[model samples]
Target: MNTRLLAVAALSALLLGGCTDTSPGGQAVRARHEHFEELGKAMKEIDGQLKADTPTSATVRVAADKIAELAPRVKTWFPAGSGPQDGKRTDAKAEVWTRNADFGTAATRLEAAAVALKAAVEGGDAAMVRAAVKNVGAACKNCHDAFKTD
Candidate 1:
């Protein structure tokens, strides 16, 4: 009788643990957060190169290419039901879903800015690179203001 009760308790614990496991939305949140961290790292790499006494064009090019590659996928990161509604810890605000059109426009703006940055790098103009970086920062800020939580 004691052995049977212990087995039943162990089974119940496993079932309860499964119920509390990360939901699909939680997984999405984690994945998107990771991608965004990569994006931030790439942007920071570019910024570091720019701040150097002699900016390495190669470093800037690699970082710019990464941003361009990641920007367009920003929209897919914030799918419906992936926000705080999932009971997951996320910086994404409810406005991301409620004001989705504006979010989309912001995402597009970031993508365009990234593309412009890539083009500027290809042009081999330091001034153009600076300007493009500014545009990318502006696009990120715009989206954060409207769609992200503090």
Candidate 2:
């Protein structure tokens, strides 16, 4: 029974090991996507708290910093050999990948805006925070408008 169990375990390991693609590039994209989605959700929560007139600077800063950190990873989704644009994402647009340069520029803008937001959060000034949030939101929206389906 022990030998049988050991054989089964070995087979399971072999079968399941490469079954999951934990490739560096693939892993990076998945991680970035997860981080960005989390950033968005966190930001929405922070925005909701802010709208409630609650002191959520710490929360907002956390979300903002997450976004800032994840922003530069946006390009990871577009791998060199990733092929001709996957529009099936529903959230993705054909043009974003088809017009690669434009997409990269937009991604860079997002990273830059996120960096600014990070600075604002670090500044810990309410007015500056608001302005930075606005700027970061604008940058995201601008890219989404052109690249995202909805």
Candidate 3:
């Protein structure tokens, strides 16, 4: 009876382990998608403020800070097996993994742009903030053009 119970327990563990999504490709694809969604939301909020005749410094600061926080984390979401070739639904291009150094540089540039935008918002100068926002947008575009699929 005890032998039969042990065998059942072992079988259950093996079955459950197989059911888990332990693949790095699956996990990275999901994480990178969610991260991009969050970054988009923050960027949209900042853009809306920039479009206003009189943008609120406080709101812009908050949104810009969020982008700064998220930007540095962008590289971490694209580990090995996270590309389109992994059979996962990822917009990340194969070049992201192939040319990793370039991708890392792009991510670093984005973080710097975000940080600059945050500083501009704190300075409470709308024109400077606007310029900084444009820089941020350009940094994002550069990365997306190289590493992401439309």
Q: Write the per-residue lDDT of candidate 3 for residues 66-139, one digit (tens) a residue.
A: 89999999989988876777655667889998999999999999999998988888888888888998999999
Clashes of 1: 0
lDDT of 2 by residue, 38-119 (tens): 8689678657756876423677777877887778878777564232242122245667668879989998998888888778
- lDDT by residue for model 1 over 31-138, one digit each (tens)? 888899988998888888888833338988998899999999999998776787755567999888888899999999999999999999999888889889989989
In angstroms, how far off is 124's CA in candidate 1?
0.3
RMSD of 2: 7.3
Top-lDDT candidate index: 1
Q: Each prediction's TM-score against the native? A: 0.83, 0.68, 0.82
Model 1 residue 135 lDDT score: 94
The 10 consecutive residues of candidate 1 with the worst lDDT sum are 13-22
Query: Model 3, stretches more than 4 Å misplaced?
Result: 1-22
* Off by more than 4 A, model 2: 1-33, 54-56, 80-89
Predicted candidate 3: what Cα RMSD to the true structure? 6.8
Displacement of residue 40 (Cα, Å) in model 2 is 1.6
Q: Candidate 3's error at 73, in angstroms?
A: 0.8
The parts of candidate 1 lying over 4 Å away from their true place are 1-21, 53-56
Model 1: per-residue Cα lDDT at residue 140: 89
